[model samples]
Each structure stands twice: as C-alpha cells, then as structure tokens.
Target: LTFNIGERPTFRRFSTPLNQKNLTPFSRHRDDTLNDEIQSIRSLLDRASSGGDRDRASALDRAEKKLRAAQGTRKSYKMETRLVPDPRQKQMFENKLKRLSEQLSQCANDMKALRGNQQRGELFVGARGDQTNVRGEMSGDEAGNMMINEMNDIQDKTKSSIMNTKNMVSASKQVGEATMEELLRQREQIRNIDDEVMRVDDNLNRADKLIQKLWQADGHGQVHTVLRVRQHAAARGRHHLHRDDEE
Candidate 1:
C-alpha cells in the first residue's frame, strides 16, 4: 500500500505472509458448512436405503456419492484448520454432533445384528456341509440320491449365505464410514471450542466445562457402544460357529 515517487507501488495486503494464527477463525465457516453437508447426506442415504423399493436403492447410491463429496470437502477443511489457536464460535455446534453421533451409533448396532444373521447363515451352510459329507460315504442307492440332493441344497444355501454376508458387510461398511466421518468432525469442533475457551478465559471454571466434558465423554461412550456391539456379535457368531463344528 506504499507508493513512492520514482519507485514501484507495492501492495501491503499481499506483502505480508499469511500465518497459522491469522487463518484459524476464518476456516471455521468451512468446517461448519461441511459438517452440515455430511449430516444431510447421511440422512438422505439412510432414507434411500429403506423401504422395499428397488428405486430407493438407486437413490441411496446417489446419496452415497454426495456423502463422499462432502467428506472430501471436510478433509480439505480439516487440513486448513489444523490446530487453530482461536475459535470464535460458542458451544452451539455440539448438538448437531451429538445427534449425528448417536444416530450413527444406532446404525452400527443394527449392522451388528445383521452380521449375526450372516454368521448364522454361515453356520447353516457349515452344518449342511457336514451332512453332505457323511451322506457321500454311504454306498447305498438311497444314500447316493440323498447325498446329491444334499449337495444341491448345500450349494443353494451356501450361495444365499455368501450373498447375505456381502450385503451385510456392505451395509455395515457404509454405516461405519458415515460414523467415522461424523466422529472426526465432532472431534475437530470440540478441539476448536476448547481452544477458544482457553484463549478467551484462562481462569474460567464454570458449568460449561462440565458440559464440554460430558460431550467428550458421550463421544467416547458412542465408540464403546460400537465396540461392544461388535464384540457381542463376534462372540455370538463364535458360539454358533462352534456349535456347528460339534454337531
């Protein structure tokens, strides 16, 4: 912004280099925007996947595409907002995070149940495999026909079980991915809020601290919930798996 006679004019706006501290609060708007986009995309995807309509499935695919785009945006925003020292926002961003996290946690549990069902189907196939093997050793004509029939039946059931597993895995992965996205956003939001609190009021001791603590605690609880569900599903699947082996 300095102009001297017989000298080139220089723009001070571009003269000074941008630093981390200066860019911190400016990047938060993008974070908020991306967080909203992710929530909407997830909701749409959820609704699209529901109902008995094949059309809904296609819509769900579209929603997934949007969610991916939003995630890309969020990634860039996170990189831009790294360890921002000061945040100008309040504690208002927590509610959206809490809702998204809880909803995704429920979705995770549902996926766990689906996984259990898939395992049960696998056990069914395993049992059939044993039965077919035993019948194949028989030399009698009746046993031969029975073994052939059992083999065909096993093939059909095995295909069904495999398909079920694929579908369940797909669903679980979709939900798991969405959950991770929301969790990351929530953590960033919390970090920014905490940083803001420390910068603005170093000596503050208030009920808001408890509130933030609860929010963090709830996030941990959601993770634990997902882990517990997976553990339970694995244990039940193992039980059924062992029972099939014994029989």
Candidate 2:
C-alpha cells in the first residue's frame, strides 16, 4: 500500500490547463500571492516589534534571523545581476571608479594645501654647533642656526605688529573720548540756550504787563496817542541805525 501526500479538493471551481506552457500564468499568480502573504507577515511582525510586545519581540527576533539568512542568499542574487562579468560593462565601471579615486586624491591634496597655507612658522637653527645631523652634511648646528634666524625674524615681525595694533587702539580710544566730551559740551550749550529762551519769554511777559499798566494810566486820551507815536518813531530810528552800521 502507498500513501499519497496530496491537497484536499475544495468546492470552488478551478480551470484545468490544456498544455504545460499555458500553466505558466497560473504558476506566476500563485507565486505572486505567496509573496504578498510574506510581505503582510513581515509588516505585522514589524508593527508588533515597534509596539514593544515582549512575545512579539521574541518572535520577531527569530523571524528576523531567518529573514537575514534569506537576505544573505539574495545578496548572491544581487551580485549575479550586477557583478557577473561582462567585459565592456566591467571596464566602464572600473574607469568610473578610477575617476572617482582621482577626484578623491585631488580633493585630499587641495585640503593639504589649504592646511599648509594656514600654518605659520619657519625652520631655522641655533648657535650651538652639534655635529650629528639627519641630512648628513647639513648638521644639527646648521639646522639650529637656521631655526634661530627664523624665530628671530618671526619675533621682530610679531613685536612690530603688536606695537602698531596697540597704537591704533589707543588712538581710537582717544578719538572716542574726545567725541564724547564734545557731545557733553554741546548738550550743556543746548541746556543754556533753553534757559536763556525761558528767561527771554519771562522778560517779554513782564514787559507786556508794564505796557498794559502804562496804557491804563494814560486814561484812553491824548497821552496814549503820544506814547504810541513815540514808540513807532523809536523803532524806525533803531532800524535805520542798524542799517548804517551794516554799511
């Protein structure tokens, strides 16, 4: 007796294929359905993991391990698609990589040049003449002397620069102080002018009151007329006198 491992028949109607070639569509559809199911399972697993469910996390970890194994197998598939040898394509890729490498090297060199530009100081030597040196004939003594000269030059330049900067700062501070003093003086002058104006206004008011009193004393008669005429004459005289002085 032989036992058969077979799928149970369902009540749903199904189409029977006439030929092997025609069966490809059905096979493809089945494969697509299986892929969709796998994707749904993975999505559910992801949600469960993110929700912090401990049981789901353990299940997800185990599922992920299996998936990672599958991904490793898929990596070979990717390599077969991308890295399998086609000489022309391979050469093109290599040339592209070479150009990128050259660009990277040039970028590195440019960075190095920029760094060199920013670096200060020079090599020199000191007076002590030691015989043993790295560059054979150019002994430690010569190197020390060169270094000493360089250091002296740098120090002299630095000192001069510092002095110049100090002078500039001092001059600026003096100018600022002078400007502030002048502004204070102008403010005082303005205050004095305001006081003078207030005094002049007070004097004018007093003069107006005195004139009104004098008019009242005159008693609306010939005395008032005489006083007005005299005032007009005096004003005219003052104007003419000022004109003569200008000439």
Using TM-score as the measure, which candidate wins? 2
Off by more than 4 A, model 1: 1-25, 83-247
lDDT of 2 at 180: 100
Error of 1 at 92 (Å): 12
Candidate 1 matches the true fold with a TM-score of 0.31
Model 2 lDDT tens row, 1-247: 2344795554643364334343334333433443443454455455543432334445455555544443443333333324424566545544544443353344334434433322211122123245354222343345556667768988999999999999999999999999999999888866766665566566556656666776778665755665676567556655654554454
TM-score, every prediction: 0.31, 0.35
Question: What is the Cα root-mean-square deviation between model 2 and the actual structure?
Answer: 23.5
Give a tens-digit lDDT track for model 1, residues 17-57: 56755554545565576667656765765554453234344
Clash tally, candidates in order: 1, 10
User: Model 1, residue 1: what's the lDDT?
Assistant: 73
lDDT (Cα) of model 2:
0.50
